[model samples]
Target: MTVHPSVTDLMRRAEDAELARRAHHDALTGLPTRLLLTQTLERVLARRVTHAPIALLLIDLDNFKQVNEFLGHDTGDAVLLQAAQRLVAATRAQDTVARLGGDEFLVLCENTNAAGAGMVAERILHALQHPADGHGAEARVTGSIGIATAAQHHGPTDLLREASAAMRLSKSRGGNQTTLFDLRLGGEAGRLLDIETALREGLERDELVLHYQPIHTLADGSLKGVEALVRWNRPEHGLVPPDDFIPIAEDTGLIVPLGEWVLNEALRQLSTWKRAGVVPANFTISVNLSPVQLLQAGLVDLIDGTIAEHGLTHEDLVLEMTETALILDRSTMMDTVSALAETGASLAIDDFGTGYSSLSYLRYLPAKQLKVDRSFVAGLTTDPRDAALVAAVVRLAHEFGMTCVAEGVETPEQLEHLRLLGCDLAQGYFLGRPATAEVLTRSWAPAGVN
Candidate 1:
């Protein structure tokens, strides 16, 4: 059993070769995997001369998951194999096609410029669009392609990243398309990444602050409540507006924690105001809830616990949700909202007339207030249609035994019009701009306030 060194070396080398082959190739499609693709790309890049460009195309199959779910995994595998075969047929013999797994493929185009790369992408998309015969039938699939050329001195990782970013842009533009990576696209992607990172850090480091916008009664101009708007006091970029970061938060699921922070912070401020006797015992604070927050489990418990901790009653808090929130998972959303309403907290449909302008939710859901969208209110004084719409909304809210608030009432004429229409509340720059707690307390607090 004590073999010579040469014999042992030969056996070890054979085993190593087998392992390398397995690692570099996909089992199902028998195409090169990401490892081999990278290696081959590196080789081509190292030998590349000026004006002799190489392009990388990243292909993502659109709605491939639906096919897998409807057909089966076996059928999905067959489709993938057929896709790989078609990709090979579409490219030159010298070009490389690799399977990146899970409905993604990578193609390396040798001596190809942007025009040639685009042609290749088009061919690939056409090939994938046709039905792939499997299980005695054909399955339809589409490809979204991203193309990046080695016109710039980019490494393997950067090239792949650029191509991937282009692919995402293609998918965003409704898929089944090709996008070429440019500086603008890269800049936008980089900006989004920076914002995402900064937002996560901002949450952890308390860089976000709440600014209160006073909501006053249309009849008396008395401060009935205030809406807590979140602002990011980013150190690098001073005072990033909510519109800039909130959508990113929603997309990244950061909104759940961000929403929780907003609730707790608003309650804490309300508690402070109550303790100082700056606001009445019945003073209400409104906080906007993202659709994602409503779908999150334990939202009720979090809200209940926070209110209880602040020694505030449910009536002292208003939860404002957009109309779009209602249409996402109606049954579960209704149940959750019902539980919230049972807690005695008022539920409001914010931007009410803008989305899903159906009267059914007002009749069915536990909504207590309807805030007419600013778009309809913005033209109330000039546009007869806008005025009629606002009046109709106010009337509808009252018919359902709910309060109606008119948003963006910027002018005296608009205020008078809303008052005539029986709007219960109004919020706009003319009433009060969003301000810090100190500024709002100084202005709106009782005359003897600190």
Candidate 2:
């Protein structure tokens, strides 16, 4: 049968309409695309005549990349689709759910204020807790939701930017949480950006310096090792605490280069100390490793080469990391720790008792030492429970053929307690604070001389 020209034109127009609809929606989730979402938001903001309350919720899937990297992109796509469905179910029919692309979804809620947005956000967060692909247990995917009310911003750009900032704050605090955009987050975000920019410049300008804190044998007071801590010596800021900038570096992927600098500089310092005969022959330098460094493909080679470059052996270095870092990525933790251990560099669980599931994770790691966190050590002399806990950890370390280290040994009494508990090493201000090589050589050497 021959089709009429009018019928052909109508069919062509219908196909064009379908194409436009598809372009404005996501293929997998069938939710509105960012283009449509933005258009809708613009319209809502532009219509000042009908003052309607509006809010935006931005959802970021935590560790979603891991799903794609480990389980395959197909599994990742399934998780994304599931998350989109949960976002829809958690909101009102008047709300619009849009895919902001790649594990990020946006919800535009009409007639919702901050408090109302909060309830919706909590619902969406809870809904996103399930495994994305039916095998949720293996993936452990969850969403971080950030809510921003239209009352907070005058335009779509500001609303989305604030929502994104809040989402990042939630993610930075550890995901599976909800955040509402606030002025505090705005200032904090700006401050972090400033710090990040300064830190990058500081690193390049050789303003990054290492200060070594001596860890001494509790019994003999002989130096056992030193932990290398990085500090940014900005011209105007003096010495910026690692706490202030280290997290920024870790989140911004600057930790990789910062970590490399720590490794090389710490090793170089240790070699110099060894040649000076100040440190014992078995003295090892410890450096903290961020989770990002563990995932680096060249981590093992980097460690080996840095050690050799400083004329040091693998045994002369100690790699310290938090258990939570290892627990979050089990497969990588095993491979990375095993590879580092094989390099003859010892591994230590830093801030040992902070994690709730510490004992459980210890079984899987080949760590040679455990550093009791400052919190526990701070209470060692006063709190009987803290003392008992430290004693148990020390004994456990001995049983496992590992040395137990007590960090933040502030007082002589605390040192005594750690010594009596059979702790192998102690580090604190009472013994020696973190110092430059010049001061450490002058201060620490005199103690060993006598």
Candidate 3:
């Protein structure tokens, strides 16, 4: 007779088997856990007798925070699950897919070369660009992919580092694309890493500051509002411009916190002016929104909360977003822009008519103001094409019940051109250089407003 197991023993063994499976799988997406992926990488590394190189592909959802923050976390979870399925569908059957935590996935291809890796990454990017659910409006997120192929002298840690660096490069370039890791990226990545660390410390030390640029009534040069611009005051580097450091912040995910601080501080300054009666009730302060910040979490609440906390109304704030960025994920962005508009705050499309103009969005965008790009204004008096475009923009904005503001007005002629074109507001060096709050309020703000 054969030895037979009891019912109790059978149940216990099945339970243990399930627990082991769970340990190696992600609870949410059912993809391989990072632990399992590592073990798979190691096994492939050690057993490799062939000359074919293995490739590691990292997938990170760009602006995923928008889903979690604007839409509910439940929606974000469903989107992640959808994303995991898409990753699996896009890869080879033999490839191992893993969830490296929160909107980031990794694939290990045992026998794939760099070219094959590129193909797979392209497919993955395409798959992720679709809506998560059947509803075209939901799950509107895209992937930023990074590829790293095994070389003659590399280990598991090196592979991870290269893949991560490539992903950072993709994100720094505004995401929704793929980047391959190479020797050139190594130094730039290292330098950016240093800046990222220093910037984090700088935030803690409160080294970032805001300067206000006056928005003027083009006809009379009277102040209407001020736009807040961020600047870094590094200890050793003197003053660092945003162009030099913002990409690092975007790549490292520091823009969210940095943006939050700017919102709060700008509102606080406006509140101070309000209390002193130096500002009219209609006076407003505009804050620039980063593309990353636009898609990050709690943007609406953060704006609404900060405004209320600072004893200001929604009408006192003017939020500006780049026209190009606004149209990136049209459906998702339109939703966020709608929610923000619902809060009664004014919205302006910044840098309007920059090459990425999407005419379709203008009709649907809830924004009531458009800032004519300085590029056109720079050529206003000289180029008839530029003059005609500015004139048409002003007329178009008025037709839609919107205000048209012209930026980068440097000369009296430009100001006169804007005034003649019926441009509502103007900002630039000639209008007023960006100045400290104390200086702007004391110097530009009228002693009294009727």
- The best candidate in terms of TM-score: 3
Model 2: residues with Cα > 4 Å off, grouped in runs: 1-142, 145-166, 170-186, 445-450
Query: Model 3 clash pairs?
Result: none
Question: lDDT of candidate 2 vs native?
Answer: 0.80
lDDT of each: 0.82, 0.80, 0.81
Per-candidate TM vs. native? 0.64, 0.67, 0.68
- Candidate 2, residues 1-450, lDDT tens digits: the string is 996679889999999988677558766778887768888999888874455788999888898766655665445566776787888998889899997655678899888888998898888878877655635535668888888778634677667766776787889888989888777655766676567778778889999999988889877877788889898898888998899888667645578889999998898888887888877788888899987677565689999998889898988988999865765445545777998888788999999977666776666678999989999999987899998899999999998889999999889899888888889998989988899878888875844422
lDDT, ranked from best to worst: 1, 3, 2
lDDT of 1 at 242: 90
**Candidate 1 at residue 144, lDDT?**
89
Give per-residue CA lDDT, model 1, range 159-184, as digits (tens): 77667767877888999999998866
Candidate order (TM-score): 3, 2, 1
Q: Could you tell me which 10 consecutive residues in candidate 3 have the lowest summed lDDT? A: 324-333
Q: Kindly report which residue pairs in candidate 2 clash with one another.
A: 131-136
